[model samples]
Target chain A: MITLTLLLISLLNGGLAALIFFRGLKNKANFFFFLTLVATFFWIFGLGMFRMSSFENGIYWATLFYISASFCITYFLYFALFFDNKNIGKINFLNHLLIHSPNIITIIILLANFHFIKDYSLEPWGKSIKLGPAYFFYVTHIVSYMGYAIFAIIKRFRNVSGIEKTQLKFIVFGTITASIFALAFNLFLPFYTYQFVWIGPYSLIIMVVAITYAITKHHLMGIKTITSEILVGLLLSILFVNIFFNDNNLWFKIIIFLVAILIGYFLIRSVFKEVRQREHIEKLMKMRSEFLDIASHQLKTPISVIMGTASMFREGSIGKLPKEQQKKFVENIYRKSVKLSGIVRDILSASEFDTEKFSLPEGRLEPVDLEKLLIKIKDDSKEEADEKGLELNFIKTRAKISPIISDEFYLTQAIANIVDNAIKYTKAGRIDIMLDEDEKEVIVKVKDTGVGIPNEDKSRMFGKFERARNARDMYTDGSGLGLFISKEIIDAHSEASIKFNSEENKGTEFIITFQT
Target chain B: MAKILLIEDDNDQILLYHTVFKMNGFNIISAIDGKIGLDRAKNEHPDLIILDLNMEEMSGEEVIKRLKKNPETKNIPVIILTNMDKRKFQSQMLELGAEYFWEKTVVMPPDVVKKVRDFLEKNKIK
Candidate 1:
């Protein structure tokens, strides 16, 4: 019965190690944890074999168990150092060698069949071993290493909170309790009472169970899906094994196996689908909160201006003012109100893309004048461009460009967003707008000599509430929804595409192509 | 009349504050951005400074940090007028040694002038 429990613990450790290592292969902490689990499997399995082995084979089994224990403790210490995503300072080769020298010496002594163990005797309850000079060395290594590992975890626990704190609580509790059991039963009791050596390996189950619970319940390493799938696979394999080896009716066994396979298929599919939905919701919630933060700040600026200007007029407290000055302040209030409305329109237009039944109203679509629209956009942006000392140029092609059937309002907003982005980013250089056409396509390009988007920022350029690092540094007031809304508007039109080519510190050019 | 320095990037805001402060019997000094604001704070030595938080070239946070660092400008009281949420930035602005934080959306120009008058009178400034 004890042997069966040992085999079960070994299988659990091996399965969990494989599942986590394969799932989180790139994580440094996961790799160390995998090594620790693998080492524990061998330690527990070797201990079980040592209990069952004959007198002559007893020495060999004892050596295997001791070697595995040495490796297990070493790996556990490394795992603890890296646990909870903790870094232990700069890693020098000499420092690593110094840290690992004790384990290396213990393994070498065991491998040479030298001094760690002098004699072994088997009894009904457990096994006993006589101590050699190196036995004290092994004892000191185990006690100090395990003690330090627990201490490291406690240190980390003090520094971290939230879900990480809870995960560490499980880890620290399991490790401390398991180490206490192993020390009392496997080392101290074995030295004095000459029994319960087998209990050390059994105590490891507490650690494994605790970590497995953390993996499934707390999403440790965020490997919940992998653990669920592996568990399902393990159960299905056991059912199939019973079917093939049992002496039950052949047809009944076959039907039960097929049913199990069907159940496993749906089980695995639901787990994957649920996890993916959860991840997507998490990403969207984060984006929405960020958008709210930026949008509130943007909205308040215009609102404040309008409120202050209106309040000044209503109070009539500033004494007599010239009519021209009053007109200017009123104009300022009017311009700010217009800007506030524009911000509202942009936000609404962007939110439309988030809805399920998003479609442009049929009445809004019409044949838009391509040349006239570009000229108007250029004229409107000229004042802002001139304010920043940038020469805004428009190059009109001599060839007649044909108009496209589209929503003129949305199309103009989209094109103007790109133009506005150019003026906002360009600190010193000029912006050029051009309109050209071939036989089947109308091409409009807006180019600027500004801080260009880098390769790292390119992937998320059109994502909601995202800004390039350089752009955020240059201007703090952008809504970050402009490009996303622009892209969506352009994509809504049939056979239309928007693309950009940019180099950092040189410039960016956005090209919009529409099927003519 | 107490001299008031307005460090604001928005032209409309500068005009509004300038007119209101002038009409309220105070001399107004204006800087369009933080770099110019810091220079004016050093040279003009305005009795009280009204600083806008976000600006091109240099941020108001950097301006206040530099102001506190400089022996000449450290004593001049600064009131942060910004569109940022007061709850989020009030404690931080205080820690940076500003005398007060006023949210632009919440306070009208008249209210601001009144506050400035009260502050100057309480401090017994000319």
Candidate 2:
């Protein structure tokens, strides 16, 4: 009965350790836990078999039991010493040597038949071994390790306050309960009366329950993802353990093994796939938030200027000046308005792509009036050219031009972007616009005598977030989105295209062809 | 006269503000960005600061954090004037010890000056 109970406890403990090993391999504490549990499994399994075996079989089982017990005690000390992830224990090489010396020596003595236990007899449910001369020394060494673990845990408990204290509460309860029961059965009762060694292993199950509850429920030791993995691992453990311990035919066992391996491989692969996908999603979310921050700031800068100038005009601050000075303020507000509206449209366009909401309002796309659009772009950008002490003018090269089918607002934006780029690049010369048309297409060209696009920059000049070398050097804060947005808007119409001709540091002209 | 330090980068907003604040006969100091703003705050010892949240060099949140940490400038009242969405940072700015928050898109130059005057009066009352 006692031997069977020990075997049951060993199986249960080993199952719990296997469950933790799924996704818990990254954690140091879990590694130590695996070591301690495996040692316990071997110790209990060997000891249980020893008590039920014949005399010759008893010696073989006893050898395994004693060796496994040494491993159990050594690893248990290591686990207790470093259970808390934050606390670095004072155990050194010398300390480790001192702690496990007695365990190592006793195991060697017992297994080598050097008489750590002279004789033993089966007591129906347990074993009775006649203690040798070295037995008292071994007891003191093991007891010291237990005392050391208890003292360390209590000291840590006293130092921590709040949630950590609560986690330690579980650990303290488990360690003390296991120790007291193990002592009562293995040491005190065995010396004075019949051995009840099976009681020690059973009480350890309570320790396992408390610690597992702490790990999963309280989130101690940061054991995340192990909960769901445990659910998957538990079912697999039962299935696999049954196949492992079954005394079936060799052919049946091999078939079961093959099937189990196939299922386990796919199960592990799926879990990792989920983990990778989650990490990728989190990275994308972080980048999107950063972009939004920059977008908000970009939108805010021009809006503040537009609103401030408009507010100034509304309050008669600019109108109170002479008519000559007053016209400049109105021009300033108009210039700010064009930049403000252009930025807003760009953001809206980009967000549609980002959020996958390609919802454009109906009837917004219509025949764009070529003459009025060019006049407005020239008027709005007049102040921008004047601010830089340059002349901006528009000329119609043809008597009549056909209107183009496009979104008027976006068409106005694309023309404004071309003119804005002219104003930005031209340092000391005039920006001129010439409009002409043939039977099939209407053309708009903006020419500037300023630093032109380099040969390398012209290819990706219209790509999103790409800027010319001189443009970025001249203006530090430009978003490089103006031309990109304009290109996207023009490209949406199948027959519209933009072309440019440039000589570096001399002059450049941009031509937009809209098929009527 | 309460010396007000206006930390803003936009040239048009700066011109509008200079006109408004000067018309009201209040002394004003302007810093174009956060790095200059922080330096001027420590050296000028302005009675109040008007801070814009987003800037090229350093952010207004970082400026406020440094100001609160420096004992010499920690007591000066702050008025947050920004065009960034106000709801996102209103409570956090208040908790960071800003005296008033105004969205520049909504508040006009006259009302902003009036707010400065009103905030000074209420602070005197407290």
Candidate 3:
């Protein structure tokens, strides 16, 4: 029974390691996965020899333990290389030495142990061997091997980013559990043999579980799933484990088996549902990333063309025109320049947001005359408003000059965006810009008599690339980043807020309130 | 005028290239994809091929392979224009007979045009 169990455990370890090796080979040539296979092969060989009923040599067990220790050491080195993202070529010589050096040492040690590890006998469960002082070397080697793996894992954990760190943590935990079980079994085997044999297999199982999860879910080595049948197999294994281990009595085992079948059905169903949800999310994210990449590239071309053409025209490379025509050309250039700048800004902002690196720099907070700034903006918007046949007016209730401490450029840009949106959306009606001052705050309200926002789309109006349903129809050319940027600027100030009031076809009012 | 073949998928990019090349007095033959670009290179026999790495059909690498394979187009120096910053791909392209690999983000369109002109002038292939 003990021999059968050992064989089963060895088979499992060998099978898992082989699968990982093949999977790694399919993806690319990964040294760590290859090392894992080597380690598992040695382990399986050791276990197979140790479980043999006809085996009577103590040197055989010692050799098995030595090989296992050597494998463990190589495993640590491989794992370290993997975590560091170091190329295999960098340490090829050292890796070759380490992998081969043990075999040479083990052979020499076994040859010398001809007289040392002599006594061997068959116990009730299986064959047993009395260990020598040389066996301590094997124990020491295994311990040191585990120590290195732990050290590498801990050292690299602080620096590795994203999913790698999570995967490493899982690996560390699994290895630690396996190591502890091995250590316990090694130490207690002399006192009680069969008691801790199961620990090794159990720990191996944990390692398998952890590695399988990392490979399938985390894409730790980029091993893509080949079939859904594997998932089905895993479900069946779960059912088997539940049925086999959950009950003590035979009749209860049968009852539990039946119940486990039902549970397994639900479990499999839930697993599929979970997989589908995860896949859907992954697909959406992938599409979103692809869309962002393509859209940015696509948008860049036209912006580049406009900017390049404008620069060429401005430089008189396209030939000079009359003064009146020049003025008209400059105006056209200015309009195209603004549009290109806005698109470029949006693209940059979106990239920054994606990378989570966007920040508003601190600016000098000495504000100039508000009235002057408003007049300048109104003059800028006049041509745009005139083109659309919309009246743009700035109404000041109080003429009192109050200077606010804020970044003037951001304030101007924010106000300009609101005004630009008003001009773009309002076709026939007038745009009213009202300034009001209180004891604590200065309020700037830009209200436009245009096609108003729908109630359903109002909530997401400030989101990036989200245009109101009515606004989208009215102004099809807008990039939908203005409101999002406006919101960001407002949030950055921490003392400003934007509120809106609107009705369909009546108008929309964006009230920007800033602390004095 | 130096004959230049521009392999670009984006319509706007192609237009930009055409305008720039026309302004700079280069005879430009453009292709929308790599396969067409290769065909144009074989038929038109351009002095140099300005290849964009990423395209909808037939990548720049595929075009480079084809160019290197065909005796007629093999001598035409290929310049790779790409957004990818991967060193491995760059080395692979270099090994596969790309004369120069320039990142689009790092090198402006005008600079690229200038480089092409310089290559033509240096080779004296006009």
Candidate 4:
């Protein structure tokens, strides 16, 4: 029964070590933990064989077990040191040699058939599991390395939080518990009561379980992205193959295989889904900050214009001039204040539109005359056009026109937005507002002969807070939300769409068609 | 009197800055945009420039880059006079050979005239 138990423990260690070590091959910290697990499997296998062997060769097997134990302890120590990477300030080559000397010396002695074990006796346990001059050396080696690992882990735990703290806690508790069991079964029980030496190898399985749980459950390893699925998938496949060979019952093997494959598929899919979501969220965060920068940069100009002009009049920078001069400056300040208010209103509307909350309360649409609306829009923008030395034109294609059913306020703002944009962009030539009606649609066209939109900027002209590359150079006062708000209002009508055609350095023509 | 060429697009600002600088006993010749500013810089050969950051056909950055490249205007010192908050481009504008950065909204027009007067008195040509 003891031999059977030992083989099972050996197989468990081997399977876990193969999976993790395969996944951990590229990483230094994980590779050290893999070495520790591999050594534990070798120790358990050699000890199990020693129990079933004759007295003459049992000593050799016992020697092999001791050599493997030394290697296991050494590997666990190195694993603890390299685990967090932040704790390793300076890697001393000499200290490494000192820590490893015991393992190297023991393997050499065991190979030479030296006096670490002079001979063996076949008691019920069938081996002198812990008896040698170097026995004390092995004890000190395991105890000291475990002490060092505990110290390193505790030091690292204080500085970490979140998932790393949880992972390190598991590793620390597992290392301490495994060390105590090793001491009780191998050293204390064998000397004080002379039994339970066969049980020592089984306790090593606890350390293996703890490390494996950390890897699979907590994802303690920061894996390489875009290829993490392949590695984890390969590891699961190896585990399935191991189960295929180990189980004796054919029905049990097939049932377990199907269940594992089903669970594994979902696990990998969820991990991929989570990774992609995180990547997308990070991109949005970056864009949001950039949008804020542009918004603040654009909004500051109008605010400064209002404040600067107001103060210029207050300080009498224009001197004690005629009443006409003072009146013009006051009008300039009033105009700038209105522009600032417009910027703030557009910003609020754009933000509301972005969140999909901008809507008319209800039943706001009304019937309106198209000719009268176009005339109002042209009249409102005529003063602005004259101020810039540009002609504003309104052309009636027909003497009379049909009226369209629409939201009057939104319709007025939409047409006004198009005409305002035309005047703003046109520094020299005339801006013409032409009205034409077909059988099914009424179209309002705005054409400008100023600085036209660049081809690159035209595609994104209707995007919120988007402006042409050279638009700011032309006029620094625009908030970049006029065209976007116009687009939104037209879309809300559900019967109209705004389209534009432009050539760089020549002109642009915007056409708004409303379905009748 | 030091000839100061003020390049700005706003009408009110041009009238204000011209009145202030002229009263401070400096010769003030101004343009409304960057392209005209560059043309006048070469033709008039002013002793100093007051450049605005915003304009219609060309940017102030482009204007300064061309001014520094041209042999005729490379030696004159430039003072930036606009509503732009200077923290974003103060060091870079100085490196581009602008001698001072004055935010237009914060400083009084007379205060700006005083600063320009002090600068000219300190670095006046022999």
Best by DockQ: 1
lDDT of 1 by residue, A1-516 (tens): 576566566666766676665454565566777888888778777776776666677677777777777778887788778873444555689987987888789878888857777776666766668877888899899899888887877787889989878877776777778878988887778677656666766767788777767766776434657666667757755654455354778788778767976776676566667776788899989988888878898898888889998889899954379888888888888878977888899999888787843455688888888888988889989988988999999897766888898888888889989999999999888999999998889999999999999877898899887899988877787878889888988888889999999999999999999998
- Per-prediction TM-score: 0.66, 0.54, 0.39, 0.56
DockQ of candidate 4 is 0.24
> What tens digits encode model 4's per-residue C-alpha lDDT throughout A172-275?
77777877787788765765543568777777667767766776577543343324544554555555445535547768767765776567556655665676
- Candidate 1 docks with a DockQ of 0.58
Give stretches of model 3 more than 4 Å off.
Answer: A26-30, A55-65, A85-89, A92-95, A98-100, A112-118, A187-198, A216-516, B1-126
Question: What are the per-model C-alpha RMSD values against the true structure?
Answer: 8.2, 14.5, 21.8, 17.6
Q: What tens digits encode model 3's per-residue C-alpha lDDT throughout A221-306?
A: 32223234354444444443444343467676566556754664455455556665777688768756655655565455445546
Comparing 1 and 4 on lDDT, the stronger one: 1
**DockQ-best of 1 and 3:** 1
Best by TM-score: 1
Give the Å shift of residue A311 in candidate 4.
Answer: 2.3
Winner by lDDT:
1
Ranking of all candidate structures by their DockQ, best first: 1, 2, 4, 3
TM-score (0 to 1) for chain B of model 2: 0.95
Evaluate residue A452 in candidate 3 and report its C-alpha lDDT on the 0 to 100 scale. 83
Q: Candidates' DockQ values? A: 0.58, 0.37, 0.04, 0.24
Error of 2 at A217 (Å): 3.5
Q: Candidate 1's error at A490, in angstroms?
A: 1.3
For model 2, the stretches where C-alpha displacement exceeds 4 angstroms are A85-103, A154-172, A215-516, B5-24, B28-78, B82-85, B92-99, B104-111, B121-126
How much of the true contact map at the interface does candidate 3 reproduce, as a fraction?
A: 0.08
| Per-prediction share of native contacts kept | 0.69, 0.46, 0.08, 0.46
